[model samples]
Target: MTNLTQARLFRHENLPFLLAALLLALLAGCAGGPAPAPQATPSAEEAQQTEALEKMVRQGRHLDAALAYSRLANRAAPPLREMYSLRAAELLKDGNYIPQSFQLLSEIQGANLGPEFHIRRVLLTADIALARQRPDEALAVLDSITSQLADDERDFRRRYHQLRAQAFEQLGQPLESAREHVLLEPLLDDPAAVQANQFAIVDELQQLTPQVLDGLAADEFGGWLALAAIGKGVDDSLPADELIARWRAQYPQHPASEATIARLLAARPQALRTPRRIALILPLGPRNRYAKAAEAVRNGFFAAYYARPRQAMADAVPGDGGAPHLEDAGSNAPPLQLRIYEEGRGAEAFDAVYQQAVADGADLVVGPLGKDAVSRLASRESLPVPVLALNYGEMNGAPPRNLFQLGLSPEQEAREVAQRAWLDGHRRTAVITPSTPWGDRVAKAFNERWLALGGHVVEVQHYDPKKNDYSLPIRRLLNVDESQARRKSVRRIIGEKIEFIPRRRQDIDAIFMVAFSRQARVIRPQLRFHHAPKVPVYTTSHAFSGTVDPQMDRDMDGVMFADMPWTLAPDALGQRLKGDIARAWPGAARRYTRLHALGVDAYRVIGQLNELRRDRAAHFAGETGELSLDADNRLQRRLLWARFQRGVPQLDTTEN
Candidate 1:
């Protein structure tokens, strides 16, 4: 109301109390206290701009909203200005404008912003690098931040670690990636997700060698390696309380106690089955040709059978001991009622020996370690008990019940080579193998699997493995000589000579070859000599000598082969066993590494074969390979792939 109106009300005679109160309020106002300020209101242009930005965001026009935020960023107040840039970056990133987001984030001054904004900018920058497929760049950006974060900042810390892991994985630094995963498990909320991420860490570390892990397990790096080991190797066979207690003692401060050990105890999967009565049928006779081979196997079986989680942890490397590496747990199951039987002079005596072993109360018979003896056993109608024969054999009729075969089969490797080549997009293949029954077997296996996978066999050529000159076979395989023949014929007929380069067969995208070291040294280079160097060559494990012979193997470079886990072990235990075997019988390992793997698996499978057979899809991760049960009672090994690089067989990253 106006002052004149108030004055008029005060002058009124009626309603004297109201008029007196109004006069007193007017006098009080004139006596003046602090003046009341007006409420701030949006100006027309500012209001319109704010509404437009909100409208763009609400309507899903992210680019327009991002542009508006960018335009308004300078006009925004201090912290709000950073928020505007960050929001714009987020919008740009979602729209796959990585470079734009990166540029915007790069321009942000973290020193002038809150710690949260600084973290966001760094994370956004790393994410942008990742989006551009520049993991190393992303890692470099992330590395500028330290591991130490404030209590309120753990979310950003976790994001930093997650992005670090992604960058490491993209850079093919799996062990580092796995370490980050170990750290990340605690940050994860879902129990299942935690377990899955823990398993992923285990799976990744399980692919590294002890030699490699040992190099890294210095300082803080050791904690994650130790955690992953426990996840992979600890099972029901271990005393849950004791195992975790021991781990806690060594790594009392590690987060794995909560992330891994506690969860494992709760899961309570059944312990690895330990057979009550076991018989080891070996070729241990003094004069037997396979005696040393059997010895390698025996050592391997004993090494695994006697191993302990603590002992493996205590040793420089797991499974590096000769035998009895750990004090007997005593609860792992009574030392298997052990019996040893030797195969006699003839195949005719095999059945008798097996029967006698069964009569002696053997329940799980491990082997007749030789192929002939296995073939003899396969001839029987049925076995008295479950028998896991060491070598797969040729049998006439259907495989007998309660009999399972586990062999280090070259044929399996050959088939895997074909499958791998096909998987790598090899449409047609040329075959050049030895002119022998063994070569025929392997070639047939490769061809069958390749054709089944819709790959074509362009041609086949045989070579003399003993011969040094492989030019003829290589030329035939590549059809280079045929091209030369056609060129010469054309030149003679027309009486004209023009520059011409002979072209190898274009239909074949890969070569399936079978060669031992002796042949490989010549065949590989000879194929290259025949102008087929660029055509990928896939071969059985025979192409690689079990032991590295750099000078001799140099020629085999660029050839891809399928080998067993025995030869290309992906785990520390396997690597350590290999080291132990080499130390004990260096000479035998030059040829018997595969047999050692067989021995290890033979003992392992006795406990797991039933599980595998029950579930056809199940695989036992064994030293030999991933062992799976086939319908024919054979435990087939799915081999590892490698390419000869710089005279070394490097495991293919694509291999499982």
Candidate 2:
């Protein structure tokens, strides 16, 4: 059958009343009465009044137009009273003047009107009450209409039940909402309402018991899964395995069956055989500046691996302190460090590392710390064991399947800042960035995320880092249009009538400045002088990377920025790693805590690759806070926001 025919058949079985109403309306319109004779001329006064009302309605001045129409209609013949009442009803749909509209309708004795008119009045009053948030009043209006409503009003009744359910839900009466759901049960089978009912059932399950969900039919499993996934504070204590088994047995062919099975299977532990050896590569030479840093990171990684309980590694590593074979990427030799296992760049490095690991019977490969080394190793086509890139790397066109990059980046910080601003309800923002490549990178990421959230970028102003004056760019960004008189007064007060007016602070709601310490110090005070201190300010990670002097702190009060969470908490793992690093080199903990934490997490995940890949969310909450692998295989971290308070970066809140 054709789609329209199939739709008609479905509706006949699902919403018969709706179909009947449409048919009735169509038939009534088709059977027309004799046309009235054309009038000689239209009333000039009436036409003028209608034109004015039309203008008011077009301008969204509903109240003014309603009053104007009522006055004109009242002064005309008795037949015009219906026209005035209709116009008044249209205006009253705004809900602001519901009570007033009801009073007007009552004064006109609407109960004595025709059946259609009475029905319209009742619906209008109920809608007004609902808009005014008076659920009880709306219910009373609908109740009064039910006794007198004709048989043709079944479709209206269905709508009334739906509206009643919403009102009861809003009023926190779940029982009443459930009762309305029962009333809508027939409509639930309608394809148009199926998805909507699914959503509603999921919402209801938040307050319902497992017994209630179990009692539902097999067809309702999809709705239950959707509910379980999205419902707030849903109790997950019920065993997922058991639930999946029951669902599979009851509805083997359900649409969501495969996905549900996958989720259940992932929750189970996978059997993995222990391998003989593991390969560890690090840059270990005298000439490299990061040679000390690299050693510290390697120590952190070992500390994390050994920190796991003895039973956890019984299968993976043989003894209590099973040592992995270490390789050195050499001294003052870029190619040696960049090339993994004496191989050239690209897949050769990956192949060499994999072959060496396999030759030693290793289960995993860790590191090749530098970005170049990582890029070269990751360019390989295949590997015998999973390689965890210890340091950050450019993923190039695509990231390696078996390799994972774990490190902090500027793009991550910018995205976090923009997301935080959006969640805080700042819909309009301006970006002030340095005219540098790094500055552009931060600005681009921030702009992309902000725009993705349906926010508007009012201005993107770039300032030359080498230049001193930023007032013009700031003013242009703020779109400051100073009043002529105020400008003249300010100019006279300063004893110089300058042509350029400085930007005012109140113009933009939020400002994102992408600059380091020195530029931040200059721009922040300028923002305050322009009366923009009240506006919330965001900056990149670079803001906290530099020295914060007394003057800088004074200027940057209340400014917030995103950085790795280790900066604040530096968890148990982080502290242990820091202590290990400190034992090797004093005062190193304070400077390299972030990189140390990164190294520890990278090591832990490499050992538990199966679990990490199986449950991505569980891999999150490490020393560096939440971390997830996006579609691109790049690790996305949940950064924390810190405010500059008393010359220190303090944890603001757990908002982002």
Candidate 3:
């Protein structure tokens, strides 16, 4: 139904409750002894104070504003006092002072308060319960207040339904949550907010499986379910736009706006042109610096290619323009024809090979493994064919059109570390990384993300990775050297020996270290010796060797890092691939596990790049990580996190 009709129905249905709420407000006003005060409400002095407190809130001083509100409540009378107290409790809750907010809300009693105050108090109680992770309690409180809401209370009704939806989401009831959002869509006034609610509805409904969608009851949210089911047809032979058109024909009166429909069609994952002739380009010449790494990637690409279903290959179509096709009795060749092009040691050679591959009918190109090679390709505005570069290139802003980058990026891992540390309640941190270009990039990524999250980098020290002893950098990073200098100054002034222990800086709650396992083994022990044994350490995947060796890795205890599932906890497909690689090429399987996984993902991503690029929620479960594409056409990997405990990297179940 249309939003206007829905809103009118809502108001009509709650007519009795509205009249009762009005009576209660009138009675409360009479009992409190002044209708003049209700008209005047906040006096001039209270207005000034409230304006000042609002200024503090605007400046992010939530605690200060809350305290000011509490003090104002103490000096105010009757309903004003309770209103001020409710505002204070809301500010406290927004500032993450959950227990204080809860206690303040509990103390508030709505005896002779107006309808607004009564609704605020009830909503505040439910909000605090939600903040405390007590979704069941929050839902119960909301249920008790649901029927008491009046027709005129549009804002309160919005908040009430929003809280109910959140509580349902917390309880793993996405269908129920979606229904609540569908109900709330008509109440939203802002265009952006309405679009967000629409997307949220689709996201919740998308969580349900096809079986659930098929068996869904034709109730109030049937149009919503139907829309979500159409969106989920990414792999369907029928185009997604056509499916959406069919849905629009069926549910024209549904609440989903025109903008939302446009967005759905834009991001719809229709069947992209499948490249029958695929070109794999890499710096694989013997003299190339990245020859061995390229070899590992090549092996991985072929492994994934060969793993495709035999029947699918047997039923292959011809290439572009109905070119002739070839098949052997037992060759087990991929349906898509594959060719490897050797990207020689120079950029000039790479260009020549890339052109040759295109001339040879290469519809899709996946390679140019070197950064410089990828950068050369990225400089172009467009390419004759799509190129999935193995390494990210330097781009001033967004990536070039038709070019995608996917690699084991340390910068991505560093950013993940920043987010993980913030989630773990760390606000201040120190970083110790290698004094090299790669370390600088990783450190810059961490600092940018950390600062964006309102975290502070107390100190950032660079260490020489070649040096086995990291005492100097560690001491500098912890400010232990400064502490020792102070102790020496005290001893010299007293003209006698002084018993003192050098104290490390107390401001930092976490340490972000960028190092390989060898460097980390030394760094972790030195950090303990320097009196930082309890401080948490976070790092990139470089800190783990990807192979388990308890005796060697015992020194890595308590260090948390993010790595691909293939290295940490391989799934059945990954295990099978790992075994196949090990038997075929043991060295690449053992020594270059991560690169091998990257290669496998590169092949898998080739087919899904269109979907990943258009749809933000689309993902491919590959050997590398849960692969998705960012706006820049760069493939982003959400790696699994693990903590080293007694030399074994345990998958953090908290994340699961």
Q: Pick the candidate with the highest lDDT.
A: 3
Q: After superposition, which runs of candidate 1 have C-alpha atoms over 4 Å from their true positions?
A: 1-273, 308-334, 395-397, 494-500
User: Global lDDT for candidate 1?
Assistant: 0.68
Which candidate model has the greater TM-score, 1 or 2? 1
Question: For residues 258-370, what per-residue lDDT tens digits would candidate 3 score against the true structure?
Answer: 68777555544332468888888887767777888988888777676666655555322322112112223235556777778788876677888889889988898888888
Whole-model lDDT, candidate 2?
0.58
Taking the tens digit of each residue's C-alpha lDDT, what string does model 2 give over 1-656?
00011111122123221212112222232246653343333378777778877887776556556655665544443335555655665574552343345445554543555666766676776765664567888788778777775555666666667767767876777656756755664544354354444445445645756675566545454445543452222446667556656655765665443543453344222312233345566554455666666655655565565555442222233221223222221121111011123222343354555566567656556666676777776666755566666655665566656676776577778877886675455778999999989889889999998886557888899999887678777767765545445677878899985886454645467899998777887888787766576899988667764333555577688788776645655666666655655665466555665666776776565545544554342335556546665544456566556778876777653211
In candidate 2, which residue pairs get closer than 3 Å at backbone N, Cα or C atoms, i.e. clash? 277-362, 347-380
Question: TM-score: which candidate is best?
Answer: 3
TM-score of each: 0.55, 0.50, 0.63
Write out the backbone clash pairs for model 1.
none
What is the full ranking by TM-score, best candidate first? 3, 1, 2
What stretches of model 2 exceed 4 Å from their correct place? Answer: 1-276, 283-296, 306-354, 370-381, 391-401, 463-501, 505-507, 546-552, 654-656
**How would you encode candidate 1's per-residue C-alpha lDDT over 599-648 as one tens digit per residue?**
77887677676567655545677877777787777998766667888888
If both were scored by TM-score, which would come out higher, candidate 2 or candidate 3? 3
